[model samples]
Target: MATPPITFVPSPSYEAALRRAAELWGIQLEFWDIFGHHHVASPETLSSVLRSLGVSSESAQSLNAAIESRLWSEWSSPVAQTLVVSLSAGAIPIQLKDSEAGAEIRFEWESGGHTAVSVESADSIHPDTARLRDHQLIRIQVPLPKEATLGYHRVTVSTAGGRRAEGRLILCPDQAWQPDFLRRGGRGAGVAISLYGLRSHRNWGCGDFTDLEHFTQWASETTGVAFVALNPLHAIPNRQPYNTSPYLPNCSFYRNGIYLDVERLDEFTQSEWANRLLRSAKVQNCLAELRAAPNVEYAKVWRLKLVFLKLAFREWLRRNPQGTGRREVFLRYIEGEGNLLHRFAVYQALDEAVHKRDRNLWIWPDWPTTLHDPDSPQVREFESTHATLILFFKYVQWRIDGQVSAAQDFAQGLGMPIGLYHDLALATDRCGSDLWAHPQAYVQGCRVGSPPDDFSPKGQDWAFPPPNSIWHRDSGYELFVQSIRKNS
Candidate 1:
């Protein structure tokens, strides 16, 4: 066998340096493209990748700086942004930068507690040098108690002269959650179906939480289905249509309001105004049109639903202007969701405001630059002016969340083991709330896709930009972490 010639630009040594740079910066150098060809990124490819990662690799000097920075950056600091240790893993490892004569670390548990034993210096803690690298570091091993709960904790390292550093301590289970259904029991069968495709006469044009509840009830009682897996219920913008594909959404953290059955809404059921609105000839006619359509007209469906939805919101607000039971609960949800919910609501309102002003405009970037930032003064002003509108979106979110929770509860009540399983889309669209809300974290220039493959030689280009893996990790997966919690 003969060795195939590998392409290395400039020279092999520069290529080696590029490889080292990629390794330091956490860029993936070797990958199997979709075409099944084993590809090692060339020097030029590495340079381009570095650019995408916001590192200057333009010339030799800059490249050397980036590589050096990448290599020694971690050792420069005694404290990292976060440290993770499995509970099953015996002692916690703490690293010190200087290995100074007098150094100590402390643990502050988020549960209103501190470490049982505190050592005055690293020498007393576990006095051992774990490794000798560019910088001298002492790995003080601290044994954890069996009762240590799983959560985010705080770890601080201090040296002589009051020089101190702090980092997050995340304690997790060594193993993933294994439900009883998957463990030793005899195997059972269940079904996975697209939420929209589940048919029932009660649903308004598309399947909904109500329909899902009914299906789960039937499947559990008669069919003996163990669990039900659903497609992504993430929100899609109305510019879209019903966005036929649940797999692609504008935002992933929030559930799509279109999935909420309007007729089942408390306001719709209770308010005379909402009832009258629903009874109007135009509303009836629009419903008929949507119900009869062979293929869904998503935007039309969403628009029609929004009209009734707004009416429901207005009626509910009219009923509860002050801090009432419902209002407080909704506000608490907004608060619990905190800035994430508020930002998404702002984006929604801003997006709709832009669309109303000019239907031709595409996304947040296409709008006035001032409105581009979720935290901008202009956006705050927009939120203040559109307070009711933002709250209305929040109400929609609450309803969707409640309905999903109810559906899951209903499944459990019916004795289903695993209950409802929700989906998370691969990535949010570049123009959507996720990207617009956190512009700094996402990679801008390139979209996500697989390279050329035998199945489709040209390959599949999913136009949405995925979170930059390097940036996401560097930031401790800031934006990506919440989506996991929300989706799961």
Candidate 2:
């Protein structure tokens, strides 16, 4: 077959603007194509990419305009979203426009420590000034003192106009902490597995937390294993077939409740709920289909597992509605998780409710417009009205949490160096709960995945929106921290 030709070549004038615009917006336009062809992205592609990155670069005039706006947005704005400083990277630079030449920049450290960056004449720290947009942009060099601690800090820039811009000052280390056992590093063996692959006699179509514990114990006892790596074990709605990929999870913070080990549930000991749940004709039929199939029947497994979980949950609640140790532990987790957990639970409930009304409306984008905004009055009303359903989601998460905690404890008891190692996804789906909860924090048109490679030809687009680089940093890398901690 003759290869199709690439369209939308750039003119010289347009090309220069595109190049300059791409440089400013940090878009890579010169990726090699699938056929070992070296090609530059066309003007249209560049404009679209730049536009997605929040740069309005559609035309030559607009391109220049966007560049100017970016200049002010980056260096000339009162401040950036954040100033990331790593001890390995040494010093950092701060910038402001000519009008704010004498702005007072201060570092308010966590140890009751402080650094005042402004002094008379701006002479104390060498200031480099360049002219752009008819104004001088000054870059001020600031050095971190050796005594500075590793934590989130605050940076404030107060301009001459009495205007103040606040930004997060993230101080990262050269490397993440590795335990002494890992640092010593002898030839310790490890294994990775899809959680669903740990099948057994009683699993509801797929593996569960109980299987993980058994596997971990067996691995540790039989082989001197250090860790067990897992693919992204993210949450999905109880809805069938579409909740397929772990990589394309609805929420990263919460585990897929389908992974809950129903047999190991406290409710099993409390009454016949566990036995009755397993005995259901629909549940047994689905489980049989899943177990007999070579590959996972994800839809069947999800439906069957959800039914069992809901039944188990109701049974547990009946026995221990309040004043129970489980309730106390769950409450403690909620307290620690704070807004993050609550918001995820609310998103799940809203997502499920919306899906029930219309199965085609699985994603938040397709939902009623008002429900998109997490904090909108309509959303708040929906939450209030469907409070029980939201709490059910929370209960599911808590149940999952308990089982995961047990798995970790089991591994630790078995003397494994690292009980679990979770793989983090590069980005989240725009249609998923994370993006729906924080829309502005992600790029709309950009995807996070590999470029064109020989195997499949046309480059892979994961269809996940990359987090806004500026916003992620501005968040003091909170999302990244949360992901790592939860997965751990």
Candidate 3:
């Protein structure tokens, strides 16, 4: 049996209304292809996109209703969904109705601090006063306090008439910081390397932080390079042929433990068991084979590092009592990371535990149904029972941070303006920790890709889910911002 081609026979007015709805929703009706040919999206495509955006576009009546509802939602809102303002900016932009002109605006910081500002109309008509129904919208610039710092904040507008709405505010600098030389029109260059491919006698099969630090120092003195650029350094499954690519990481928020230099860790230095393991004949032979290998043995390197790292962590626990110096520092770092770190640690712990029990179960979805969701009761119980294992993962990230920070400081001390330039991968492994942790932050049924280009005439499908823009906006882009902050 042959399937017939479907047809859409919308009326003229309905077609126009549909196109209008698409435009309002920021869907492009026309585009120029790679071959310089102009293309217009079909009505079917427009409707499909609109549907994806959660718009009601089933028919003329539904689309018209959706447009009206969207407009009213936007116009009646007390503030924009999100606002990015410079620290030196005079005021923050807000929208309000004439009836709610006397609303009180509150500025709340993420650090449990807040400041209040009054919203008083200047009696001047805003340019956006497109009248909606019987009410008119007014735009006002609420004065910002001078002490407002650079970070994410929240804004709430409350009126005496019982109307209330909230929005997100991101206070940032006018520009990113750069060295004086670059700001003064000086040209600079640096070498980029895949850290794992850097061969050295000291590194155990793969390049570690110590290798990077040493390279930075050598490059500063010999190559005269301004900085060293490295690959994503994102944590991966560390498996060959499939999961070793840095661009598709198991966890973007944390670094791969394989990059840790076991010989240099404070815990390793303090632990007798770690020292003996490092010097053992079996460990030495494994390290030598890995170091001399033609390619980076990702699995071997990771397995070796895991053994030493676990030993070091156990030693630290035995020596550093609760509330002690290094223990307190480690706890503080975890506290600062908050739930994000906790979730990543939980995922890593689960990954290890599940694989140990059943080697065939590689991904989270293959696990028991109750353990699939991060917020499930089973997961909570796992966290309680596997607290130390989760902490070990966090400990790995903390040490990586310390070493990278030290390298940056060392580079600056030696006159290299930027010590380590990190590249953050935009794509996350679908079967990785990120997707398992916050599945709602991504859209299903479609993979993110680029249009046809010179290199890839057929176009490219990256095999990763596109982020849920609506979800990020509603959450004030906390996860998105955290990704960049963690890499930095």
Candidate 4:
């Protein structure tokens, strides 16, 4: 990628414009592609932009036009006009156009090992175009052929000038959704062990996914255990002396990538040093000895694994290029299922946050004015720079997911009724992604906890925010259902 040129700007007016736009849109807008071109717009900015576009004076019409116009203008002129072809869709309202010759749009797909393209709009989409006083908006709803592949399919928008815009349509598997095993059958007939708070010597500095997997394997083979309940594997902010508690993770959906088993990298390729290390009598004996041991020494194991995993990741990247079809699918999964992923990313970001102590959490909000709002431009820029760290978190979760699934498959191969069951934390940290992302859904002041009873005299304040019962009820427990679905 080429580095965009930076241009200096006049101070007061430029700063005023940015503030005005942000206030109007409720989002900070900074231009990266356009040098020194900062145009931030909020809902209010939409209204302002619409008025400037000569929409009807009625409030309702103005609001609607404002929204549509703003969305359209965001991609207009230099962004759109320069393109030989353009494409867009969904709630963001994708638009594709060609400046030269007006061309007929075509849709294509492979059928029975042969490629085909649509001849007419009636065969698939309703072709429609709208012309405003100064601009044109084209709307086409292209329908896929019945024989279209059940995964990802490309859609192409073409113009007469031979210019084209390409986009994708993902077709998810048409399987019937399964309810959580615990929910449907009431915990089943299985022994439940709390794996939380177990000390492990093999983890880096804290118990990790490797420990969980090892325990699951042992529980399955030695005892006929169907489920291994463990603590939340959420990403902790990368702060040194990392957060030791599992329940207070930054992101629940995203896996803490650091927990990826380093041993697996050996399967990728041949390295003299690695091969020799594995073949050495000392290393061989260590592996053989650990196989007979009941538990792992986490710190030692992690240190060994980290050394190899880095080498493997480098080799893997060298063989596979970025933005490939596989990579895109992976990215889509993250974007679609990223609420939890974002949490993990936020956690990692906090670890790298400025002032070392400021990990995007409120230690004492009043102390640092700059660190107060997470949505500020400074924070957003920080996130963009460290976006790869977030992706790393997602990749790690994917690897762990594969391992856990393999464990389940192994149990099922032996004809077990229930394969695997994972434990979910009762609540998330108040300063974490869950609370920050869904502010309206969380009650900030009161923390979730168990009331005092026979077990203990004083009530417990877990220091985590519980889902608002009222909101859950009204939302048909969608959050709960989604969480269960993800775990299952």
Candidate 5:
């Protein structure tokens, strides 16, 4: 039998490096020059190659002894190599030189030292014209093993002409876990309707905090309900006509300052003009009118509340000329909470940046390339200028936290088993704090939602980004734990 011709094309240094590597490994390489083509020998030809490389028996034995004593870490660098692994299934379909004539392309996985699995390419899979033109992407569904670890996996594609292309598979860890509170049953007790449905005469158009309080008191005393779960009371970006949905709020951390009780304003009592206005029975009349109404007109309630909130904010600021100590306490609370508060504040600042049009915070694709780098001066400056805004947002969150705690305390006092079980939205808003703070953790290309089932034929896109498993692991689940603790 004639041996296949193999061509060996190597620079002098390259050949020396190959010899050194083989010598260190106690292995011999069978270099064959087949006509003009050079090919490395198969595993079976390794012994002959070793002898040709001048690796004597004694030297090989010494190399093996040295290798056995060295730890694996000494040989394998932590820096992972990128490998292009291809996977396919179903009918084996391949594209030949002619598009009309298809051939079978064998697919296989060889995770060095592990059993190989043969895969069949699907006929339905076709080359993407745009991707092919750009030579940027390959369209193929790769089947991943259930036990694959998180990191880079190697993949190789081979064709008849000995052509090969390499790509990397980023295997992310599966850190999917059921939320602690979720395991305890969700919304099983009865669903509560929005308070916006309640009618009030005092309100300019919609319900107010007073109305919320009144309803809570009523529900607690009459129905023995301990907790009254309300939608986020976060401030709205627009005040002229507030948005009807509670889900899309300007800041989840801040109390809708509009909901503050006007009657509770301390400075209002000191103002003769305010006193006269109140004495005229306007305030009393509004409350009396709301008491008589059965349903809330949000527009009317908001109109009335808007006027009151503006007056209250002004009066409160005037009364606290030295700046309220509450601000200091709020700042302290956020700092104590660490990254949770810091990230929330960053989101709030980003929101303001979006509103002011000073900087494009959301989907800023056109931003200078340098700003993406963490160590860039531009990012540092942005962080510095927006630091106060972030703190302000944190202050708002502190207020909301206090309010929630108070509500829960009130409910507990009434002997409710669950006290105040707050509802967690299915996912965080894409442009909100979570996504903004941890952009790396979110998948931007796809929205997270459930597939269509018997319940509904139309699938839903919740418009929220699900956390990336890699990001969560790298962060040590700090964000996850903090979110749970805060809500709990």
Candidate 6:
């Protein structure tokens, strides 16, 4: 048999504009497979990608128009949308049409102080010039001062003609935070395990922080590891097979309440109701069944733990009252967490309320359209009406944070250098609190996925919306940073 002759297809007239537009929009035009085969993006794929990014690529004129609009918007601006200044990278970039006139740069630090870019300091900074459609686009680098602290600040660029533009200026460290041992050139290893899979005779069917502390000590003693890495402790729906994966968590900023050691909490020890419930034969039977089961019973464990946590929360409220120092600590935590924790708690409260009213309502999208948005008036009313219920969820998170901290402290005290190494999941559940609370953070039309590899002949569709890079940068990447800081 003879192989068929290879057929060549003519490129579209808009192909050049499409590629240029894609490049400006940060879309990959081609890729190399693991088998050493080069794969160039087809025009259809490129158009679809451009559409997803809110750009039009239907024809040559549309492509050229989109490209021109983007370029004009960027080049005409006095400064870029965002800037990062690391310890090693000192100068900040700015753009203006008049280079001879120069521009003034001012920074408004998060600490309520202001700093102006000095003309003498940036004397050595070079200026690069380019020609736009009709005007000259000049790019200049202004030296950042050594006194700038590591945080998010606001930068304003002003021309002599009174035109100005503002952007976020993020001052970051040269590298991420590292342990002292790693900084000193020491190498170490640890046992990575799924916290939910950890079994202990004392646990209530699922692994808790108490179980973690004990396991950490044992692992360190037996394996002589510097750290014990655990799976992401992110909160999940805790339902059956569909909603239990830690990697696709209900909320990236919070931990699963099931891992909380209810018995270890002070409120649990103090609550007569909680103790009585635990002592009951009905509760004991459920605990025993869960513990003896071959797999983690996510639903049952979550239900049981939630009940105990509610009781404990009530007991805490009764014992500590509002003015006490202990109560103040929790209040401070809520305040420190700001709107992020509040929105999460509101979503949880709403989820429980809606599901209880209609047993079929599983996700936020299925809830009443009015309640879909966290900022909607109906949702705000629900939050106001169910303030105490929302506080219960917050209290659960507060207790979880304390217990997890204690476990980490125990591990560190046991001579482990890195102590607890918590993992952060890249994907957030589409139907989870994060989506319900902050839908703007993600793009709606596309799901994040990976190309085919040796592991699987078919490509993988992760089934979660890709983050909106535009939104993240506009918000100064607060949500992204919080995902890390809260998990850490």
User: Which prediction has the highest lDDT against the true structure?
Assistant: 6
Q: Candidate 4 vs. truth: CA RMSD?
A: 15.5
Candidate 2 lDDT, 374-450, residue by residue in tens: 99999999989988778778888887888888888888788877788777766666778888877777888877767
Q: How well does model 2 score by local distance difference test?
A: 0.74
Tell me the lDDT of candidate 1: 0.74
Model 1, span 1-488: residue lDDT tens = 32332221232355566676678677778878765778777888788877877888777667666665654445445566667788777557655544465546677887877764434344444354333234555545666755567877777777653567777778888788767768766666677878776667666677788989988888888888878888988887755532446677788788787788988987888878778877889878877777777865677767777888998898888877777897787778888998888889888988889889998886777899988778889988898899989988988998888888888889988888878877788878777788888777777876778777778787788887757766665565656778888876
Runs in model 5 with CA error above 4 Å?
A: 1-191, 195-209, 232-244, 247-328, 357-391
Candidate 6 or 3, higher lDDT: 6
* Ranking 1 against 5 by TM-score, winner: 1
TM-score versus the correct structure, for each prediction: 0.89, 0.85, 0.89, 0.49, 0.47, 0.92
Reference-based lDDT, each prediction = 0.74, 0.74, 0.83, 0.49, 0.47, 0.85
Q: Any runs in candidate 1 off by more than 4 Å, and if so which? A: 1-14, 32-36, 97-99, 116-135, 138-140, 145-147, 184-186, 241-244, 470-478
Clashing pairs in 3: none
Could you list the CA RMSD of all candidates, in the order they appear? 5.2, 6.6, 6.3, 15.5, 20.9, 6.3
In the range 1-488, model 5's lDDT, one tens digit per residue, is: 32232212222343343454455544435433323434554533443344343333234444343333322212121111232222222111222222222222222333543222333333334542111221222223334544444444444444333434433344433353443454576432423645455555554335545566566666767786635676555444433233444575443434454444455445555555555665567766775665566654444555565455445444544555445795466456867877656655564455446545753334333335554433467666777987755654554455446555665666667655555545444455554445545667655654566545456545467766556543454444555545555545
Per-residue lDDT value at 280 in model 4: 82
lDDT per residue for candidate 3 within 182-253, as digits (tens), equals 899887789998999888989999998888888888899998888889999999999776689999999888
Q: What is the lDDT ranking, best to worst?
A: 6, 3, 2, 1, 4, 5
Q: Number of the top candidate by TM-score?
A: 6
Q: Which residue pairs show collisions in model 1?
A: 241-298, 241-299, 242-298
Instruction: Estimate the TM-score for candidate 5.
Output: 0.47
Worst lDDT 10-window in candidate 4: 83-92
Model 6 lDDT, full chain set: 0.85
